[model samples]
Target: MEPIKILVVDNEEDQRRLIGIILTKFGYSVKTVSSAEAALKDMDSTNYQLIITDLIMPEMDGTELCERIKRKRPEAKVYALTGRVELYDDHKLEKFGFDGIIQKPISMNSLKETIESAVENIRRL
Candidate 1:
């Protein structure tokens, strides 16, 4: 069986590296992109099982990225990662079509659980 492919999008090199390393260790095929624009370009060729993007980014934010992704691939599972969780309400996130939200200073357990749950959800669909 092929490993689940996940994209981690973040402007911070450290954050992207940390997420990539952790997901890779967990037996996922992980890719990292520095911006939503890059992520969009990557998506054009790859079908990612899950996409986890930082909520606050330059030019295009995570919500905008999610919107764009959904337009092209409505089945795509996307999660918003942000330190400023207080800034977004559930309605806003739901409107943006995010499958889930991952708070910054991520907990490995939570990240794993979220990813597993998302994969399971995808399989059910």
Candidate 2:
């Protein structure tokens, strides 16, 4: 089987690298982008199976990125990472079309399981 291709989008370099390292350790093909705009540009170039992005970004936030990805590539899975969970409700997210959410400062275990679960769910769809 092909290794699952994942895109990690975050404003913080450390955060992007951390997520990339963790996902790469799990045998995923990970690409790290500094912003949602970069993510969008790369989305068409690479066939990413999933995108894990920070909610807050300089431009083209995670929600907008998710929307664009969903519109362009309906099968691409999206996971939002943010420190402010209260900024958006579950129903609001559903409207934006994100597959799931990951709170900031994620642990390896949770990050692994979340990615695994999201990838698995995408496979089933």
Candidate 3:
């Protein structure tokens, strides 16, 4: 079976490393980027099955990144990852059309399940 390819975006190096470790353990191919701009540059060069990014970053927050990703690759699942519960509310994610979300300090199991469910839905679409 082919590994699921995921692009993980976070300004914090430690957080990005943790997510990468979890995803890699699940046998998925993961790429880590420090900024939304870096993620966009990589998107132009490579294809990804899903993109998991932080809601609050230095610039070009996750919502904008999600919008751009959806515009460029509508089929790819977009996830908003953050510790802030506020980002999950206000119906902003739905309005932005995010496929799913994973909270920050995410556990390996939770991350795996979220990714699996998101990928399944994308496959169905």
Candidate 4:
């Protein structure tokens, strides 16, 4: 089977590339974007089933991005990658259409498990 194609959106170059590297090591097709706008543009040409976006950004935040993406592709798995996980509630985030939240200073093992579960869930569907 083809590896899951994922799009990551983060304004921070270091964080974006780091995630790309990690996801690549996991043997997935990973694409990283520095802004939600760029992500949206990329989506116009790519069929990305999974996306990880920073919760905070310049013009458009992750919340808006998530809502827009969900509107366009409700089945897509879009997760929020943030350092301020404590600043928001899971229920609220879910209501806003986030599939999950991945906190900053991420744990590789946990991320791997989370992605594995998401991929498995996608495959099952």
Measured by TM-score, how close is model 1 to the native structure?
0.96
lDDT of 3 by residue, 29-122 (tens): 9999999999999999888988999999987999999999999998888888989966487477968868777887787788888888887775
**Clash number for every model?**
0, 0, 0, 0
Candidate 2 stretches greater than 4 Å from native: none
Evaluated against the true structure, the overall lDDT of model 1 is 0.93
All candidates: TM-score: 0.96, 0.95, 0.92, 0.97
lDDT of 3: 0.87
Model 2, global lDDT? 0.89
Query: Per-residue alpha-carbon lDDT of model 4 for 17-125, expressed as tens digits?
Result: 9889999999999999999999999999998989999999999999999999999989999999999978977998999999888889878988898889888888887
For each of the candidates, the C-alpha root-mean-square deviation to the true structure, in angstroms, is 0.9, 1.0, 1.4, 0.7
Cα lDDT computed for each candidate against the true fold:
0.93, 0.89, 0.87, 0.92
Cα lDDT for residue 66, model 2?
91
- Point out the worst 10-residue segment of candidate 2 by lDDT: 87-96
Candidate 1 lDDT by residue in tens digits, 27-120? 9999999999999999999999799999999999999999999999999999999999899877789899998898889889998898889989
Q: Tell me the tens digit of each residue's lDDT in model 2 across 53-100.
A: 888888688889899999999988888998898997777887899888
What's the candidate order when arranged by decreasing lDDT?
1, 4, 2, 3
Which candidate wins on TM-score? 4
Runs of candidate 1 exceeding 4 Å displacement? none
Model 3 CA deviation exceeding 4 Å by range:
none
lDDT of 4: 0.92
